[model samples]
Target: MFVQFFYMLRERGVPVTPTSFLRLQKALSLGVIGSIDDFYTAARSILVKSERYFDTYDQVFAHYFRGATILEMEDVELTDIAKALLEEWLKHPQEMAEALGLDEEQLSRYTPEELIRYFLDRLKEQKEAHHGGNRWIGTGGTSPVGHSGDHPGGMRVGGTSRNKSAVKVAMERRYRDYSQEGPLTEIQMSEALKRLRRMIPHGPRDVVNVDKTIYETMRNGGEISIVFDRRLSDRLKVILMIDNGGWSMDPYIGIVQTLFNYARSQFKDLKIYYFHNTLYSSIWLDPQRHLRPEAIEEFTRRDPETRLIIVGDAAMAPYELTGANAAIYVGQKESRTSEERLKFLARTFRHAVWLNPQPESSWGYTWTIGAIWKIFPMFELTLDGLEKAVQHLMKRH
Candidate 1:
């Protein structure tokens, strides 16, 4: 049973090593498997390491072990249970009222679903209100009811007018009003606030401090002196490779922005390349460029001091990392051969660190992640990991 469970976890992408499997077996042998909840607790303790892994484990456990009856039950059945629970409380209305410190009249006024729906509805309404009016188009500060504007055939409000020509005029008027930059609607305002918040720095050290550290390292010819000297001499170039999509966007964006800021202040000779998936045979410095036959040769001749930092979730199509692969998205048209590019990148970089938001355990099923892991040092997207990478780079220098 334990072996089956381990296999199930492996199927679900949890990284269960042979050593871990043995430990789990040992734990299970010592204990009497009493309850389902107890088993779940033991399994989680032995198997799960990261928050991302825990989430996947919960999902897989539910799919594999949750009872059929539990799975089959719909919200209606839950509603029935809620109703029964409510009724039981109603029977002891005086005691319930006293315990809740609520008046009998107030308690009688609402049903279970009614109370739930009331709060849900209130929340929905509040969200809508926060976002401002929902009408997609506007009519020159006037309520969307018909209004005339200066146009050849005059504007028709709301519906299409008798003259098809007038429809264009109406659309022009609507577009004009819609494009105006008034006080942003609730949603726009909220998003703007979020962006502003994201831009604010959180770390103890500012970019100036980072620059100072680099400068100090350069001044001292011990370790970091070599890195700076190589960078200045063009013997080494830092290539910051970032993943710009999916679940990694938020954390990677923050990490990249911070690093970019630091680099801008500290190192002026660095080159950064951004890619979504694995690097193929021919990688262009600028992805928008058409890759020529000589692109790979030209890239190799540069001999840049490459310190590659790959930030991603590392979850992609399995073939993306294994077997024969081509450029992601752009087929053979102007893209590089994927496998060759990745190999070249690995060979070129002096130090390569892969920052993954999905954690190490989640890398089990992802072929691409495992492939990248073999080539680059993989670390969780945490402050400690970032600091460790920085320290490693500093030591390398």
Candidate 2:
């Protein structure tokens, strides 16, 4: 059985050396392979570290073991394993939950779901913490390099002595005392206000004079006269529509929280809507309620000054993107064709932007993303992209 596992991994392009096989053999000899669960744990300890091997491990494991031993092990189903594995990925959790056929709230309450979400969130938070979403932070004023210190042909120092010196230097640097100031009671709100302020015009004086004047008046007083500024007439209202699932679960919630904070501080009238899929004929204004026949009509009759920002990965079944029944709740009879929906949505708003998490290079391969791109030409996938989108919106306004 151990030799079979080794051969399986080897065939799957995993570099399972003789030393690793020997280590696994010793572990098995120590009576660690009493049950399938024990065998799996031991095998993982011996073979897996970087999860890049997980897909191969899973494929080989499934191909090799197709009996009750693998299937009926401790009530753990394939979905359970998939959830466990994917919790580490920076992908959409809501989509994963849906694909796994698990209820979102119910899974959220479970230990496994909580563990997965927590891990993924922490990973993203750490990535964001490096430079607050800048992505191009310099390391000790060094230019950004394609490779870290680990690449074989990279400019990193070689040999154990050099590595030890580097580690010593890193350790010697005194860690800053973050304890001086306790964690802000409301970091999200604070960050949101800051981001909104950053989006305001900071260009030539003449270009932004009217905007600055209107903003100043609104800042000092409660409101300003729209008649005073001709440019204000062209400025569009903004409606930010966001997804509430997968990796977006936390970030979207944060965005909403930040928007609310901006609304309170700036006193700007902005509308936000939440949806799982793209809006076709209509969207449910109240997420608590299902989509009604009158929803589209109500949205259409709203002020034409509105601009729309739709934030989601647009990842779903291909049919969901183009078929007659693509709308979330509205039946085929009431559903708008994809093109018509896009046109109506664009016409309703002065400008439209789609903020997607998946990078642009991956767009065309995904049916839903491709469909969204066809509709919203300005779809973007990075923090910088989002910041630029905000700038564009403010400039148009």
Model 1, CA-based lDDT: 0.49
Report, for every candidate in turn, its global Cα lDDT versus the true structure.
0.49, 0.52
Estimate the TM-score for candidate 1.
Answer: 0.37
lDDT of 2 by residue, 1-397 (tens): 4688788679767677888778888887888688665565567668866444544554555456542122212323222343346744326657756755676775566564364555544444544444222111111234222222111122222222333332232222211121021111234334422344323333333343567667777877957634232232112356766565333333233333333344434535566665655665555444433443235546678777565777777876666666766654543454556556766777776567787755577677777677677777564534456566666655544
Shift in Å, residue 177, candidate 1: 41
lDDT tens per residue, model 1, 188-235: 322321211112234443234456557778788544632221111222
TM-score of each model, in listed order: 0.37, 0.43
Clashes of each: 9, 5
Could you tell me how far off, in angstroms, the CA of residue 206 lies in candidate 2 after the best superposition?
20
Model 1: residues with Cα > 4 Å off, grouped in runs: 1-236, 245-251, 284-297, 333-337, 394-397
